[model samples]
Target: MNINKKTQTNDEGPEDSNVHGFTSESVVVSNRVPERSTKVASYLDCSVYARACGIETMRQWFDYHRVKEGGKPRPPGIPGDPSHQYREVWKGWPQFLGTNNVASAHLSDTAMSLTDAKAWFIKNEIQTVKQFRVLCTEGLRPPTIPACPEKFYNVKYSELLAPKSGRYLGFHEARNFVHSFEFNDYLEFRAYKRNNPEMFEKIPSSPDRVYMKSSPPEWTSWPDFLGYNRITRTRLEE
Candidate 1:
């Protein structure tokens, strides 16, 4: 019996080549895809998740916890009490809404104001004991919330494009909108401070300090409204 043998050849033409037909030396290149700017814009649009919670609230909560735990101490033992256990129970709560989860709801209910909530947090949670007295003298001032104009309320995309529209204001509008007295009962108190420097000074600087020191006068400006103190001053200064 004779067997037929076929010879191998390299004559595979373009049509008979791989799906993306190309010579061994001819490399096929594709253009790079552009980045999606829409997502960035959307993120920018939605950056104020916690702005509604107010700056004073944030500061007070920070101070309360900072003092209570001696500024970021390790978690307590498993059999800790309600206050200590609450810390571990919701360690990642603030990452979700950028505010203390355990305290946010409580603050909202009792204070009916984020700032007041923070104040209450400091009073009840931080300064409840005598060992935490150093926090009272830290001289950390609560940030003033900004005044969000009517433009902030208008949600039209076209309005966002406007130069002066609140949507375009970015962090300024978000931070201020949350901190302003418009969302709380302290509007009259805040306004009174703004109108009368001497009288405002007579009021305590911090709710904690009210029992300890004299208050400062209230002043209003785009800076105050946006909580644009020395730290945040540069964000919108230009």
Candidate 2:
């Protein structure tokens, strides 16, 4: 039989303590990779690295070494164009673009927050494109208005899917602020007590207080959200 013994230490903290004859303070960081001048690698899930290598920013190196020898450079999108090709691409662009932007915040060259990412979509005219797409999805043609200062706008897929992407707080955490309501839960609780006095202690607490102030989200009601296949909707043309 084996027994694990424990010891008492100073009041410092776990960071300052050593136990079971092991010490984290004794560890040292090292970069001693076995170096091979040119390492072979597979070309999958590494487009970003390939993209870096393909960049011809310096011009001369690209002009001399790399040419369009890799058979048409990249595969084409959907053969021929559809009216909603851009929309379809826009909806799935993130999936096609991979999770690179998701890691942009951690990259040294670029810094992006959720706010910055939202701003980028607006800056790149994606909101207008997304609104057009969503409108098309509803079989509604894009409206061409000369000028209406009060009614001009666009929508972004990211902002449309808020909460998940950090645009707005989801309702589960903000139900109390949306509205107020009255219920009969407490009445039922009282009736139960009167019917079974001996079981009063076994009765559960009334849920009336929990949803007394419950309400739906301030935004328009979400419809067919899951049915939309992850593509989102917005007030831009709803």
Candidate 3:
């Protein structure tokens, strides 16, 4: 059954027309295939003809006739699949349309690996997933970069993209460095931290909070951690 190339302004329906089982009425007719069928016709009115052609959607039926008449198949990502703009048509044909699977298996296989992606992010100064997504939205992301790497790679993107510094020191090592200062209390420790911003970058800002459980056995409290003799100080003050 070939869809007619011309429009039908006459009152004659599909039965009277030379067109096998299709008409331009209520259906978009393209040189190849129409984009989609009109919702004006109820499903019952369109389903029989659609089923007879072995096509599920109105667009499929039109494509079948169009091809039968020697029109080529529409290009990929155009009229073949429902896009974000086709949500209205998608609702009516839930079984055949509106699939949300955007991640392409081919792209996933060919795109940059997670290790390379992290290095690229660091080089480009992209430290957050939100920034990466914004770049993807703006079409600034490279073809090698996966749009949703966490979804594609099954790992947390934030942790993978975290900025790594060579100067970073572990809790115990940083505490050892702080103990060399012999600070009297938290105030003195804060004063030193304020003065030496570069040193604090290597150390945790709040050791009390960061190393609560992980601190070494010598870690009794903030005073002890800072090498402050609180007992001796209290005795001297009294």
Candidate 4:
């Protein structure tokens, strides 16, 4: 582990004849020949010995000298290479979408919305929107989102929807916007109605337009009211 930082002088002209133990100095000379080492070293001095001894030796050497320290712990084994255990644990972990399943599909959609937001922000020079999109989506673009442009508002929604834009809106953004509109509860209640119109017609609407009391009536127990059972009946009727 005897590593030396070699320094070269301008006048040295790339070659030196003066040599010492594991060290050399260069001097400017027109006919200097490259030095070759012919002496054999012990097993302890070989690179194979170093690798066989493992990266612990390197870590200890680094830690003792306070060189390039303080980051996430490097995986064990060769300093730059991952250990077998590291590979086994992260074998299927998705790098782009976090998971390799249905949730990844949803996240991919969220990424598209963020990409649009980013494009709009860059085009308008809206710093806040740009920052928000960056924070929400992380740095990398998701598969469903378009490639981010240098400037925003340069592209139109029509362009985005076009085949050339190669991007699409995701369900997560749609759900978020709908929730922001304060229509989530209504949408949830009417979800079944959308699938079965006849059964939806059978379930009676609230007698009072607004339930202002401290405790609202339990619609599930009311026979004519729309509830889980009514929704199920609609599905069955279908």
Best by lDDT: 3
Which whole-number lDDT from 0 to 100 does residue 199 have in model 4?
A: 46
Across 79-165, the per-residue lDDT of candidate 3 in tens digits comes to 332322343433333133222223354666777877677667766767676676556545577767765566556677653463444
Model 4 agreement with the true structure over 1-238: per-residue lDDT tens digits: 2222234455443232322222232211222222333433222222222222222332332342343564333212213312112333222113211223324435444444534543443443333434434432353443444333222224543332211111212223322322332322444545644666564443323212211110222222221222223444331111
Q: Can you write out model 2's per-residue Cα lDDT over 1-238, one digit (the tens) per residue?
A: 1112233355332352232333322211121111222332212211222232232221222232333643222112211112223332232211222333223233323334434444443443433444544443343431221011111234334342212123222434322211221112334445755776564433223222222212322332222111121244321221
Model 1 worst lDDT window (10 residues): 143-152
TM-score of each: 0.16, 0.19, 0.33, 0.16
- Better by TM-score, candidate 2 or 1: 2
- What is the per-residue lDDT of model 1 for residues 61-151, given as tens digits with 9 covering 90 to 100? 3443364666432122211122233333332223322444434434323332333423333344332232222333343322221111112
Judged by TM-score, which candidate is best? 3
Tell me model 4's lDDT, rounded to 2 decimals: 0.30
Residue 165 deviation, candidate 1, in Å? 41
Q: For candidate 4, what is the TM-score? A: 0.16
